[model samples]
Target: MSQLFARVVRQAIATFDRKNVASFNKNFSVLKQLVDQLTPCDINLNMDLTTDEAFSRVGKAPVTYVNLMEDEEFEFSVFILRSGFTMPLHDHPVMHGILKVMSGSAMIESFTKEEATGSAGQQLLYDPDAVRIEVVQDEPRLCTNNDESVVLTPTKRNYHEITAVGGVAAFFDILSPPYDSNIPFYGRRKCSYYRVIPRNGESGKRTLERIPPPRDFYCDRGNYEPPDFLRA
Candidate 1:
């Protein structure tokens, strides 16, 4: 890893202790400083694939980060997405996370989990208008050169989608304990899904559109292939 990459990873991991929420909150200031100190002109876009397993398959991968402490308290990673790439909408079963854009920009859309209406083996109907619905209006906001970072928690912020726009975009992500799939999504309580609607028919003003009946939608997994790095 590069020296600078090593430094940031080390700093992130150092801030993972239980008594560091205050410190972690404060770290953004320092993170901003680091961002200011970096010039896109000086940073090399990491196009190398040999460094990561996921990336090796695609020829380019998001930057790799090692969360020094990997437990329920916190987890961290460096994300590098190519222009036009999209990480689909999904939920972190039980987690909170932060996204700090390192370079370029992205359009992130997030959905608040809400009550579901449906039966087993049937399509789940997500409340289009639920009191608990919240979306990242400015999230997926255009972040470049150390603007305010995006923070997400399982309760306040979850079910977000990320798309890279313009050039390649990189960000530092911190999630608590990572993700596990065994947990269910609707109990004392479980997670729910919701859709968005224009609250006032305004250009961009949106509200959750509660689904009266259950429906189904396809989840896009994305299509990425390895470029011909070894073409004859």
Candidate 2:
């Protein structure tokens, strides 16, 4: 199975064509077929997580990275998540993507930006006032060991966040034109951010409950602070 995945990775990289998006479209099934062969039951498929320590706290956040053929219209990255991990609601600029949970269950939330407003504009660098957020999809979706994957793109379900709900969840992802700088994170009804929001009690679990969804519809502001360990 590793050999097959390796071959598919190579094929994905080789198929990168800057001028034509169809190059990737033509080879899409190759990737789909390759990932189908992997199952959560196979421990050999565990992802190596030495690099992404910020996400390590949730458990292993192993990722398979691929380089695009310069000028290629699209590229791909695949990930293997341990039982309690998540990739929170985030956005990518001028690009589209997909996440097909190969096994287990996933809690996914999809959002779109709302127009900017009032104090939100002054407080946010991206004219937080200019941003508005809405929830498009939020639910626990079952992804069996060999089922169809989720699809994401600029046109389809474009912005979303995902969490591993059952055991480990593995997914295949595709992004077009690669990731650019203009992606955003949730701040309004679109998603929630983790901060030291005041809690009613000292209990660690209690803090989790006091947190509220982003009320201003903000996403991906570079000036935010993450957990200390995630700092590089």
Candidate 3:
């Protein structure tokens, strides 16, 4: 399975054609097919933490990530979320991602950034003063094993929130250009959270508002141990 995933990533990277958007579509299509084949048992996961009762403590981690491979080209991770827990609505910045449920299930709410009042027809990237001026609309959906969602560049479905449904859910996550941008002039490449609220005084209108993530929502780290074949 690891080797298969590696091939998928390799093909995904190879399909990265900056001159065309078709490459993005093709790469994501490849990843969706590959991710659908993964499951929690593939990594020896014991599903469902909701019944434990001890999981909701303030200092406890509601989610944990096991790294499969995170390099300059791509990142592969397995996210094990406790039942009833949530990973708040967040943006992937500039990235392409594919997520597939491995065990149990989850309800995923997805969104795409839209031109706001000030930046109509343009994306106000890294504009601290222009955030409130931009707008976004939410498109919600539910997903389970084999069910998937893909995020495309140029601000297409870049934000989402995930909730484990029925019981503990684990999913195979794949991200391209793996979340690291500590360079000068560019905002640090990291996850940013948000909330959907009425556009200030417009009671009938709603849009995304950036906010800090809940402190208690942090994840405990874990080591990667894929099927031995990939290691060999």
Candidate 4:
């Protein structure tokens, strides 16, 4: 690992290991700063692969991932997307995430589950069995390496879809308190996919329906090689 990436990992460990909210926030800020400074050169990313010609040659899969590290506290990985390929909208239940683009560019669309509220101070009914949810959608953003890192908390902007922009794109992702059976309270937190439910004469309200993972979407594993700047 590069010195910068190692520092990021250490800070992430420190942040997630904290029991106090203030301490965790402090460490998380530091972690984000470190991650924001990262670039393709830091991870020794193969810039050659992030091009149209190169993608056509070796990229059989629409998406690929390199697992950097994972533990009880967090999972770190890099995801690469081919041009025009998209990762469908998905939610990260009770987790925190940070994503930083490393190469090329991508478009990100995010959404958050809506809170139950009424017009006249009365609580609205929330139906869990409906298998559909009202969500607040954020404006789509085009992200590149120069852009600030994107963040998602447990409740805010917890679901998102990512698509490669002009060419092949790659990004580093850090998910804290990873989705696993070991998670407390929420047992076996697994990723869930969603599709937009068309609004019938509803102007402002947007809804999403739970769906099975897209059969056409799959990721192939790629080898991760640490940068030459440092060794672990």
Candidate 5:
């Protein structure tokens, strides 16, 4: 890892190990600052992967997860997005995280649940017009090579999707209390997909909603080639 990336992991530890909510919240911006300092080379990303090669393995492997640091407090990984690909909107269970663009650019649209949707596997009918919803990041802010960061929490913009721009894009992702069942505290990190539903004839920002996302997409897990300092 580079000195800058090491700094990010250090602060990430401090932020997740915080004893109280206020303390954790206070350290968020601090961690964000550290994440803002990362670059594509820090994680040894494959800058040469073409859009054709990337989308080729869509259901097989749409993104690459490069592990950096993993412990009790938090887990850090670099998620590389392929060209012309979009990570469909999804939820983060009860965890908190940070997304910092490490290379290329991305358009991120985030949202929060206006009403309780209950646990996964439960089926329910929904009325688009009746459900209360809000567009937290309406315009899908552009993020390029650590230029900006998006903070996520259980109550905040917990559900969102990301679209790669200008060929390929990647980000340094930090998640607290990782998605595990044994090390349970903030509940298991369960992920549920959702499909965005537009209101009536209006489109864009007029009104929007997210229903349980379809399960047609798929991907394969691959290993991360760590940098010199991050090598096991």
Candidate 6:
């Protein structure tokens, strides 16, 4: 790994290794700074590929991913979205995520679940067959290589939908305590999709209903070759 990316990986391990909240926060702050300074060149990613060339190499998949590294503590990968394609609304159950756009641009819309307020909240219906929950949606933002990285915690802005704008886009993604089937109380740390439920006349109330993953969306694995800079 490049020195910059190696530092990022070390910081990620340090951040997640902390049992104290204060220590984790301090380490995570440093991790964020390192992530912010990263660029496509850092990984020797080619942002200049023509659409035809990209499709020829990765096939016609709407999305393609190249896994860089993974361990019990974290998984680092790169996801590339075809033009006008979307990753759909999804939640990273009990995980912390950092996303930094490396090429092109993308629009990100994120949401955080709202805490129950009172008796009404307590009485809200929950069916394992059809799960739904109230959430606060953040304003949609366009992200580019120059934009600061986006961070999501287990509780805050934990759900998001990402769409490629204009043309193809790629972003570096890091998830700490990477999804696993052995999370104690949480059962499996699985990814779940959601759909926004219309609020009718209720102001400030938005609901997200769990849904099956879209049939049209699928990710294909891309060939991950070490960057040319690394060879040098």
Q: Model 3: which ten-residue window has the lowest total lDDT?
A: 125-134
Local distance difference test scores for all models = 0.49, 0.44, 0.65, 0.80, 0.66, 0.79
RMSD of candidates 1 onward, in order? 10.3, 12.2, 4.1, 4.0, 5.9, 4.1
Residues 99-170, model 4: lDDT tens digits:
999988999999877776557664433332447878878778899999989998877788899999888889
Assess candidate 1 and give its TM-score to the true structure: 0.49
Ranking by TM-score: 4, 6, 3, 5, 1, 2
| Candidate 5 structure quality by residue, lDDT tens digits, 1-232 | 5787767766776787746556876787888877777676765666544244655653546676667678877788777777767888876666688898877788888875444453674422222233334434345688887476788876667778888887777777888767763343344445566656665554453234445555544444445576666565
- Between which residue pairs do clashes occur in model 3? none
The numbered model that scores best in lDDT is 4
Q: Which stretches of candidate 2 lie over 4 Å from their true place?
A: 1-3, 22-24, 39-44, 47-86, 111-130, 133-135, 138-140, 181-232
RMSD of 5: 5.9
Task: Flag regions of model 3 displaced more than 4 Å.
Answer: 1-3, 16-24, 41-59, 116-133, 152-154, 182-187, 200-205, 228-232
TM for candidate 2 is 0.48
List candidate 4 segments past 4 Å from native.
Answer: 57-59, 116-130, 200-204, 227-232
Evaluate residue 124 in candidate 5 and report its C-alpha lDDT on the 0 to 100 scale: 22
Expressed as tens digits, the lDDT of each residue in 141-206 for candidate 2 is 556555666655443344565676646555656665454323345222222343222234433211
Error of 3 at 104 (Å): 1.4
Candidate 6 lDDT, tens digit per residue, 54-107?
Answer: 766534788888887787778888999988889999887777889999988999
Candidate closer to the true structure by lDDT (higher is better), 5 or 6: 6
- The C-alpha stretches of model 5 lying farther than 4 A from their native spots are 18-22, 48-60, 115-137, 181-186, 200-216, 221-223, 227-232
The number of clashing residue pairs in each candidate reads: 13, 24, 0, 0, 4, 0
Between candidates 2 and 5, which one is better according to TM-score?
5
Give TM per candidate: 0.49, 0.48, 0.76, 0.86, 0.74, 0.86
Query: How would you order the candidates by lDDT, starting with the best?
Result: 4, 6, 5, 3, 1, 2
lDDT, residue 9, candidate 4:
71
